[model samples]
Target chain A: MRFTILFSISLLLTGSRGFAQQRFVLEQSSISFHSDGVIEDIAATNTNVSSIFDASKGEIAYLLNMKDFQFPKKLMQVHFNEKYVESEKYPRASFEGKIVGFDPAVEGLQQVNAVGRMTIHGVTKDVQFPGTVERKGGMLAMKANFILKLQDYAIKVPQIVWQNIAQQVEVTVDFNYRAQ
Target chain B: MMRRILPFVFLLPLLAHAQGDLLDELNKTKPGTDYTIATFKGTRLVNGHTIETKQAGTLEFIFAHRFGPLDGGVYEMFGLDEAFVRLGLDYGITDNLSVSIGRNSADKIMDSYVKYKALSQRSGQKSFPFTLTALGGVAYSISPRRDDEPEGFETVDRLAYTGQLLLARKFSPRLSLQLMPTFIHKNAVSKTVERNDHVALGVGGRLKLTRSVALTTEYYYRLDPPDNDVLEAQTLSPRYNSLGFGIDIETGGHVFQLVLTNTTSLTERTFITQTQGDFFDGKIHLGFNVTRTFQLKKQERR
Candidate 1:
C-alpha cells in the first residue's frame, strides 16, 4: 500500500499528465477576420466557437462553424459560406496547437508562442502565432492575432470579384476557458 | 519489483491519455444543431422566390427591365426599343418574415407581398431536409379606361390575389432546387370563357459555375388553362408557359442577374398565367434585374 501511495504521489507531482491532468473548456470566444480589398473592406466575426485547453501539457484546440460567421451584409455572409469557404463541404475550421511557454500556475499575463496546424476550406497548414495568455484563479484567457493568405487553404478568389475581396486577411482570436 | 511495478500501474493511465489528441477532446464539447445556410444566394432565382429571407433590419431595392423579344430583329434593334420596367423595395420585418412593394410600368400595376419562412433546412442535432416558405400577394391594375369599358371599372375589378408555398433544398454546394405551388385569383378577365382562378407549379434551379457567378433557370407550368373546349377558336393570346434562364453575378452588396425569358410581364399574377409567347418559337425577351441590399438595422451587433 505504501509503495502504491508513493507512486501515486510521484504521478501527482509530475503534474503534466495522467489522472491529475487539468482540462479547461471554453466559456466564451470570439474569432474575427478582416479582408481589405481594393474596392471594399470586409470584416466578419464568429462568436459561436468551441474550444478546449489542456493546461497541464500546454495543449490547446479550437473549432468554429464557418456558417456562424456574421458579416455586415447578409449577402456577403452567404457568399462567404457558399463560395469562399464552401461551408457545405467544410462546415468547420479548427486549430490544434501547443503554447510553448505558458505556465498555467502563473497568475498574470504572459506572452507565448503558439505553433499549430490550422485547417479551413478542408485544407490544413502549419501556422505559428504569438499570443497572450492570462491565468486568474483557475481561469485561463487567451488572445491571438495573425495574418492568413487566401491561397494558403486553397480558398480561391475568382478574377471577377477580385477587387471586392483581398488575398490576405488578418485574423484575431480571443478565448476564455474555465476548468472542467 | 513491487516499487517498479507500482509506478508502471500509475504510468498506464497516463499512457492511454497521452494517446488521445487535443482536437478529439475539443470535438466532444462541440454543441449540436446547425442550420443550412445559403440554400439560394438571393431572394429570387431567376423570376421567382427561392426560399430566402433577408435577415431583420435589411432592406433590398430591386430594379428589373425587360426588352422586346429577341426575334424582333434588326428593324427593332433586337428589342432594345421596347422596355418594361419594375422597381421594388423589400424589407425584413423579422428574421423569418419580409414584406415587399413594387410597381410594374407595363400595365401600371402595383404589387405587394409578404414572405414567411415557416421552416428552415438544418443539419446536426436537429435537422430538416427542406425549407418551406409561405407567400401571399396582391396585384392591382390602374390603367386608363378603354373604349370597351365606356365607364371606368370598379375598384374590385382591378384587384388580383396570389398565394404560393415555396419549398427548396440545397443538395450540394454547387446545386439547389426550388418548387413553387401557386394559386391566383383575378376579379376580372376580358374573356368570359377564361377561368377567374389560375393554378400553376413553378420549378427553379441554380448551378454554380464560378466563385461569383451562377446559372439559374425557372419554368412555370400552368395547371389550369382557359377552358379549351369553350375558347378553342378565340385567340386572345398565345399564352404559352413561361420559361427563363439567368446568370447571377454577385458583388459585396449587389446582385446583377441577366435573364432571357419568354414573358415580358414581371408580376406573379401575370407571369404565372399570361405568358404570350413560346420559348422555342424564338420569342425570348432579354432582361436584367439589379438588386442592392442595405443594412438598415443590425440583426446581430458585432
Candidate 2:
C-alpha cells in the first residue's frame, strides 16, 4: 500500500511540469503628457511585453521596447514619416528582468516584485517594478508605472526654447500577454 | 474695345464643348471655381463693419479677392461695399516679400506697405509655422481743411507707419487661432498727452465652423487713452480705432461675408485717423465678395 501511494504522488508532480510558465502581453495602450503649460499625447502598440515565470531557470523575465511608439496628427504624421523619429534607424525600446521570490509550484494568484533594465530612445536604465502574477489555465498577467528623463537618453533640449519645455516625463504600462 | 470682343472669343470655345448649352455649364461650375484659394477663407463681415468704414482700412477681406488688386475704385464707392482693400502680392523684386497698396475713403487717404514671412513651421512644435514679419507703410490724406470752414477744426494729414507681429497656431483639425500685436505711428502727433503716436494694441481670431465657414473678430484698443481735449466745432466724435467682427461663409470657390464695425478705414493709417463705426447705433455695413479666377495657360508653338 505504501509503495502504491508513493508512485501516485510522483505521477501528479510530473504531470504539472512546463504548465507553470506564464506569459502576458500588452493588448492596447495610450500615454499622455501635460507639462510646461502644454500638452503632448502619445499612443503605443506591439512594443511592450513581460513574462511572469521562467520554466528553464525558474526566473521571471520582463521586457519592453520603445521604438514602436507612435504619435498621431495628420500633419505630424507626414513629418514623422520623413523627418525625426526615423523609425528605420531606431526601432524599439525594451526591458528585461526577473520577478524575485516567485514560486512555480503555487497554482493560484501570486504577487511579487520584479526588477529589470529598460532601454528607450537608446538609453537603458535599471528599473524595479511591482507586479501581480496568476497561474490559471496556463496564463499570466503583469503591469507597472515608472518615470523617465529625456536627458538620460541623450535627448537634447535647445536653449532657445528650453524654458517652455520640460526635461522629465512619466511612463505607465499595463499588459496582458497570452502564450502561443 | 478689347473687353467687348474678349467675351465672344472666350465664349466660342465653351460653346463648342457644351454643344450649345454654354450658359448651363457655366452656372454648374461657377461656385466651385470661385472659392478655391489655398489657405482657409477668413471671416469677412459685410454688415457695416469697421474694416469697411474706411475705403482704405485693411479688413480680413484678403481671403476674398478685393476689387481685383490695385484698383482703388471711385471714392471707394466700390469699398462702400468693401472699405479697405489691401492687395497682398509683390512689388517689383523681393524674396518671400509681398507688397500691398490700399485706399481708405472714410478718412480720405491712400496707404501702401510690404510684409515678409521670416520663419517657416518646424516639426515637434505647435503654433505659427512662420515667425518675424515686418511691415512699413505710408498714408496720404486727401482732405486737409478749407480756410472758410468752421473754427476749432482738426484736420491732420498724417503719414503713418505700422509694424505688426502675426503668430498663429493650429491647435487641432477644427480649431486654429492667431494673435496680431501691432503698433501704429501717425505723422500728425496727437495734441493730447494721452494719445501719443496713436499707440494701440490689436488682436484677431478665426474660428472655423466647417471646411468653408468661420467666425472672426478683431479688437483694437488705444493704449494711450483718449484725451479730454475735444474739438467743439466737429459734428461727430473723433474716436481712435474701433472694433470689427464678421462671419465668413464659403461655397464652391466664392466667399460671402457679413460685417459689423465702428471703424470705416481699412488701412492701419486710415483706421487710426477715422474710425466712426458704432455697433450700438446699428451703423454696421453688409457686403459679399464674388471672385472669378482665370488660369492663364502658356501657348505652345504649332
RMSD values, in order shown? 3.9, 26.3
lDDT, candidate 1, B1-302, per-residue tens: 76657777766765767665978766777768878887776888777777998878899999999999988889998889999998999899888999999999878899999999999988888989999999999999877455444465777898999999999998877788999999999988866667789999999999988767899999999996875445546755657778999999888678899999998888888888788778999899999999999989755655
Cα-based lDDT at residue B165, candidate 2: 61
Clashes per model (N, Cα, C within 3 A): 0, 52
Please list all clashing residue pairs in model 1, or write none if there are none: none
Candidate 2 lDDT, B51-159, residue by residue in tens: 1111111222242222211122556553454544433222312323545565554555666666654543332223345334455566666555466434554454345
True contacts kept of each: 0.54, 0.00
Compare the candidates by TM-score and give the number of the best one. 1
CA shift of B136, model 1, Å: 0.4
Poorest 10 consecutive residues by lDDT, candidate 1 chain B: B143-152
**DockQ, all models:** 0.46, 0.01
| Each model's lDDT | 0.85, 0.45
Sliding window of 10 residues with minimal summed lDDT for model 2 chain B? B48-57
Q: Give model 1's docking category.
A: acceptable
